[model samples]
Target: MTESTTPGTASGIREFRMPDVGEGLTEAEILKWYVQPGDTVADGQVVCEVETAKAAVELPIPFDGTVHELRFPEGTTVDVGTVIITVATGAGGAPAESAAVREAAGSAGAVAAGDQAAPSAPAASDEEIEPEGRQPVLVGYGVSASSTKRRPRKPQAAPSVPGQPGAAEGGPRRPEAAAIQAEFNGHAAVVEGPTGVAGAAPAAVRPGGRPAGSAAPSVPGGRPLAKPPVRKLAKDLGIDLATVTPTGPDGIITREDVHAAASAVSVVPAPEAAALAEPVPAAAGPAREIRIPIKGVRKATAQAMVASAFTAPHVTEFITVDVTRTMKLVQELKQDPDMAGLRINPLLLVAKALLLAIRRNPEVNAAWDEANQEIVRKEYVNLGIAAATPRGLIVPNIKDAQAKTLPELASALGELVSTAREGKTSPAAMQGGTVTITNVGVFGVDTGTPILNPGESAILAFGAVKLQPWVHKGKVKPRQVTTLALSFDHRLVDGELGSKVLADIAAVLEQPKRLMTWS
Candidate 1:
């Protein structure tokens, strides 16, 4: 990913566009913005972090300037080449430009302040409680400031006469009470029909505790009077809007009214729960279920895994091996002067073993090109290590693992794992791998049928290393043992070829001395 700056709408201002962070990727979600609008930023300062389908990457500003605006807020996915932020190339930003921006903003800030008297400046004492007069809207949007413009009070429609043209019903006249607007604690509210309107009218209730005394505004077909948000809330809770009472101005159903109806019909109430109002209270009942939207790395991982699982014919072969000798070697290598300060673990040796095994059975390290009806054999190994990060599972590969010495491979492995854990692995670090290894052993798992990484032919699942009774040298003895499972794409690797690869890896692990001879 590269950051570039282009001349903005105004002079001395540069707009920074969201860069294509991965090969062929068209968009990235803004995970966070480190700098807010109006903050001073220097050249090369990391302003935000973004997540592409492949990995999370930090984007740095390309030039020194004061942040003029953050075009998008966090959690927004932006298309590549779209301008995401603008900067003013002045030490503290030019006053003229700032003034121009404010003029463009107009009363949007007052709306964002969410108060009645937002246009007036607040006293120093009030500033501690209220926000500044010139507050920015959600990413500085004018239309989204939530205008304080109230709808005009809908006049009571002339009562529909029975048997008249366009009368709703031709039956006897139903006595509907007149709607009465009331002030409840200094707020304007309209009470619906009086408690005597009909069945289930909710007991002569409050206009401050007296049942509503007026007719409500209704649609031509009598579908009930509710705003879109209130209707959505009722639908989500499985509440019928027609059953809810209207306590809002102009006979409109409210969110609180729906909650009150819901509480009235609840089958059970917890002993600790209490009705804070006449009947409206956020039910203290524990939620039955919760839903989360899948996105970012986790969503991408799921898509790739599903594709690989169904597209590739996988065959997993397992073998249990004694690694007592290998375990002893790991300890001795830790003390060796040449290996000092280097990572010395069984996984390092396991990786080396796998590399050697691939060399012996090169056919297993190839891909099936169905479109061309050809087999693509790879001469070099770009080894992938499956890492579990907070975002999801990611397999970042070492560029050329077969040619690296033991110390070099160890250092690379350490760096790869650390970068993944820190959520800093770049998209390029995770591409172009011939094979992968997943160390399920770290979690004490015995074995698993590991899935192949998309585009790769094989994967290895390494199980926990533990002391077990084993037949060794014609005798049963306590030995350090572990299970290894190798899964390969059957179309590319036959059972015989897969078996040989698995056997080779087990042999090297069983006899560490074989690493020198095999290589």
Candidate 2:
């Protein structure tokens, strides 16, 4: 099976393989298909929506053509590099060979390893095939040529007759006849039934050949039925499927079931002891439970945070700052004609100050390359702004933020915020961040030790600004003050470097005019 464009045929048939939307993502579930067979599709038209582990991405067809066939149905999880659809480029009726190929590709039980099947092609000579068309390249993604050979399927077992001797009353016999015959003959056997018991009727027995009322032999439990995304959620939360109650249709374990089980277990005082004791009654538990599966952005964020927290040596430093001047400057910028129609807030200045600090202390903007045993210092800044969306926490960065002017930066920030709120941030917009700033101020929090984004060296947490009594120029007065906490990877940023970066940000925010001289 392979992607094909049959030669000498008027209609140029093309197979569209699933793309790796996120970096290193192996598979995605087809949430919906917009076009079906015989539907006319133009170049760059979205034909389907797929939900990967990272996010739900809309896939666009690369070339203009009429939809020849949809190889897979909606809700099917397809591996990256597997052909999902076919397009006919030329006009006229659908070819006969196309129908045959589509049938073979759509056959049940034809899936290979990783749940992917190659697209079936016409059995034509090599000379009949023409050069393939230009492959589609999605932004921030690389394309790879994948083999179309399908993996060999596992051999199916022969059906067993019930009530036969040496076989369970209702199930196939363990240590199958071949094993028992091999033991007796001292060699491998090809016999289908146990010796002298081919048609003999056995007594009433339960599974594992135990008497009807006797205890049955232990065996592995059946797995819970759930979608791939739900299964991933359970795995990330470290919840066992067997322990969860099924509430979905057809006795399937839904995402809500997994979350409810997790919540119930979380409130238990001692999990180990509770597990050893008898189960709690459903009526005795909470009246109503809302369980949400951690998936897409949320799951990725959790795994990345755990890895960053444990792998990188984090050293956080805090500083109380008088940002009265910066706050005043923000008010003035809001009215300035140059900054019109742009978001003008404390975060704008704070972000600028952080960028300036990074420029001053370049070493603080480096990443730890454990594979090469070196520190990779970045020349430009891809400043990450951590935005908390309904889906999860995402940090989409401003590309080359070091070069953007105040107005440009503000506009970018506005677009980033709006896009994040609308849940349209692309995977590329969230990658290659050098440093991150999480403004806890929006929630009116004082400050917190922020965790570093994976692959970045430092993170800055901006606290809420408040009026506090302070000595200003030998006088006691109310001053706008805030606390800033900076967490950095100690492997790349030393204590001195971290302190300098934080101090520089504080100094600029305090003076507001120092940005002119320092930067």
Candidate 3:
């Protein structure tokens, strides 16, 4: 992904939008920020690191100037093409003007003290105090003043008869739950007093009722404070904002607060009903479970696996092979002068054996084109080796493996494994593979019916090699043995073709001399 440059505005501000970091990815999470407001930056300077569905990548700024603002906070997943940061590109304004521009933009989204309506200012008129300044022209948020609408209050209950409770006090009729509508978000809620329990009575009464005091949270026209997104969320969940207590700064309701309120509404009873309900003990220690947000490679991998599993009909075949000779050959290759400085391991030979099988059975290396109703046979072999990393499982292939020499193939395989292990495998490296190999043997696993990588025709799972008693030449003998499971898209490779490919790999392993005659 590259920086998107916007034409300079009159404020000398240039908005830098998030680019499409992967193949048409819609969004990326800002993992960390390297610069803050007022920090000087240069062209091509790395400003932040972001994790898309594919991988984590560093984003560099294309403009050289003071970083006027960072639009989103760290860990925020922003949509592609949204302005992530803005810079003072220096055009039609003085340095002071630029500084003020930055300040206005920064403060516009900030929470302020006295964010609620002033006590002297009546709330019944749907009016709000605006910050005094030339409003910063943010893209999504409007500059118009914000206001809240108070729900109309219901009438108080008629005074009780002479013998009733209301009559005993010789006072006016007491207000019902709806009477608190004016002081909150118009919901007939069990109003809580300053002590944070339900009040003895409703706070805001209509005409001919108790006068509201400092204890009354909001006046007749005021509504609960929340951002537009939070308001939308509350509306979607059918929750009244006033009934939801705000925990954010300056009495603003946040998404978490709204969600918590929704959950409470569903599970917990109202205070009046719960008064007669049995009490339960509160939790006494740290939470029992932890939550990890899935993003980047893991998310993409999960989606791909699901799609592959359901879309492609897979057939797996297993074979047990005696690889005592192949093990010796691996040691011999490590000592070969031509293989010096190259990584030598059983995986290297296994990869070569699979490449040979694909050459012998080319139809197994083909893809089913459902849309075109045809089979696409590939000529070149992009042999994929599945490597597990801290981020996730990524299979980066050695391109054109069928043409590579023994030492060259060893070098490519080594580089691929090391790069994936270090979490440096690029998106391009993981794309367009025709076949794959998963070395489950590294973990001492016997075998697994491996799932095909999305878009790839087949995958091979190599199991643990260990000394086991076997009938060698009709006599009991100890030999190196391993199991191999090959899973292929049945739509492309039939039973005969799939079996032949798997058998060729086993044959190459069993007869080490085939390396001289096969090619």
Instruction: Provide the global lDDT of candidate 2 against the true structure.
Output: 0.69
Q: Name the lDDT value of residue 245 in candidate 2.
A: 60
Q: Is candidate 2 or candidate 3 better by lDDT?
A: 3
| RMSD in Å for model 1 | 10.4
**Candidate 1 structure quality by residue, lDDT tens digits, 1-519:** 343444333437677888888888888888988987778899889999999888999999988888876766566667887777878885545422232234233333322332234225332222223243343333322213333432222222324566665344322222222122121111223223332122322222332333333322343233455555456556756665645666664345666676666655433245534322233333366445433446678888899889999999999999999999999999999999998888789999999999999989888889888899999999999999999999888999998899999999989999999999999999989999999999999999989999998899999999999999999989999999999999999999999999999999999999999998877
- Report lDDT per candidate: 0.71, 0.69, 0.70
lDDT, candidate 3, equals 0.70
Task: Tell me the tens digit of each residue's lDDT in model 3 across 1-519.
Answer: 444444425657676888998878998888889987778889999999987776678889987888866766565677888877877777443222332233332332432212223234443445334456544443333223335433322212233367776454443433433344322542223333433333445344323333333112233344444555456557756676656654443234566776776665532336644222123222355434333556778888899999999999999999999999999999999899988899999998899899898888888888888889999999998999988888788788889999998888999998998888876677778788999999999998999999999888999999999999999999999999999999999999889999999999999999978877987
User: What TM-score, to 2 decimals, does candidate 1 have?
Assistant: 0.69
Candidate 3 residues lying further than 4 Å off, grouped into runs, are: 1-10, 91-129, 132-247, 250-289
Q: Model 1 clash pairs?
A: 178-214, 179-214, 179-215, 205-210, 205-211, 206-209
Q: Which regions of candidate 1 are displaced past 4 Å? A: 1-12, 90-286
Scored by TM-score, the top model is 3
- Single out the weakest 10-residue window by summed lDDT for candidate 2: 211-220
Displacement of residue 411 (Cα, Å) in model 3 is: 1.6
lDDT-based ranking, best first?
1, 3, 2
Clashing pairs in 2: none
